[model samples]
Target: MSRAITSETKHSIISDFKEITKIRLSVSVVFSSIAGYLLGVESVDYNTLILLALGGYFMVGASNAFNQVIEKDLDALMNRTKYRPVPAGRMSVNTALIIATIFTILGIVILYTINPQTAMFGAISIFLYTCAYTPLKTKTPLAVFVGAIPGAIPFMLGWVAATDDFGIEPGTLFAIQFFWQFPHFWAIGWFLFEDYKKGGFFMLPTGKQDKGTAVQTIMYTVWTVLVSIIPVFGVTGRLYLTPISGVIVFILGLGMLYYAIQLYKKMTVLAAKQLMLASVSYITLLQIVYVLDKFIR
Candidate 1:
């Protein structure tokens, strides 16, 4: 006998759907790509911008859904992920698979309307994230390296979507975020070491949050800081940072570096968590700096 679904139940399911897709993270990804697009475009076309946002969101959401599907069993063991739709048994694998498939097709089709190159990178990001990074998480710490490739794409992707060219400008943008990920995600790995281990994920650099991982975090944070200021030198043609904005970027990088140093000195979960939040603030502020710098100059 079928039980008639209530309005409340319907809302709950819709919420679960959103949760399964990781709407917040996908939205942030779209924002990064749009910033890239805006930086590349001579003049913004609000219509195409809207489409790019939608396309980016769907593609990233699809990748997240696929990751959940692959990690459903593992997710169930971890406290942080155990309540997720897939692990909770609220959404079936087949149902999530169908949604992922639909999203991937829709995303690629919409992105293709921009250009073949844009669409190609979009597809490649999904492939590398799901196929390479997802499965590799449990196998090796090198997964972070693989994951950063796709992670860095959105910033460069925007430039490609706008210009359809792979040049030093985009490459420089990619490098900034590429190095940024080492410390950003390593912080998460440090704080959640036990939680991740419950699910067999060794995300920390040395598979543990030791001095080795701390030293690496500090090294990458330095790299991230250096690259963040490079645009002010005017080498990246499209991305110019005035002296003022360059100082601001440097200051924000220092804020993140401070937390990274704290994580190293304390080697405690609270310090690692603080570094995680600081990394988030660093990236958000850095992106804002880039967009504002573009306009100020």
Candidate 2:
């Protein structure tokens, strides 16, 4: 009976760790870093790739863990986040903080093995996400803008890891992800307006579900689409996309734009959710397309 109880406890602990780190979300962010690395690398370095994946995951996980610790009370007020490890009483704040600290240290060290610039960016991402973005969420709508900086870094961080240089190529990658975030997050803010209000979060531009917010969503979606195809102009250095790839990217952008337009026209939760999904698909597929274009061309 004691052995069975121990096994159950171990399973529960693992589950709590996953919740604290937001494992799935961290893995997706790691994917973005890997995609960037693949685009910049002349030849695949399995060792660097593995290090990037581990370092990226640890950095993102640390950010998420710290975020949960900082927002424990607010998270408990919101239905969507109320059941997270810290907020739901499955884990203590100190435990989560310790895990976050360890992850942050390990992440920086691992990324440093790739390059100092990569480690520097990783440290900056953590600082912005935990210090700048987390506290600002309840204070103003601009938190999303601040949050986008760290959120976009992972995409370009891999490039810096591969090349150990910060240049136009990585800058363009950063810009593409940066603009994409506004619409993606605003759509989530729209659908979760009520839930966010319960936690005193001013996520939307006007702090309510209305036309002004929808218009901005449409505007940013347009920017996201435009920035994504800028590589075709051959100004992004080694990041140039072939005409065919550019066309495909434009079509994908249009698909996401279609959802954004629908969200504006409908002004419903379903439309917002659809836009959110489309944005996720758009970013993931965009990364894949960029990597494939680099290899094929």
Best by TM-score: 2
Q: State residue 268's C-alpha deviation in candidate 2, in Å.
A: 0.3
> What's model 2's lDDT at 260?
91
* Number of clashes found in candidate 2: 0
Off by over 4 Å in 2: 1-4
Candidate 1: Cα lDDT at 233: 91
All candidates' lDDT scores?
0.91, 0.95
lDDT of 1 by residue, 70-178 (tens): 9999999999999999899999999999999999999999999999998999999999999999999999999999999999999888988888899988898899889
Give the local distance difference test score of model 2.
0.95
Best by lDDT: 2
Evaluated against the true structure, the overall lDDT of model 1 is 0.91
Clashing pairs in 2: none
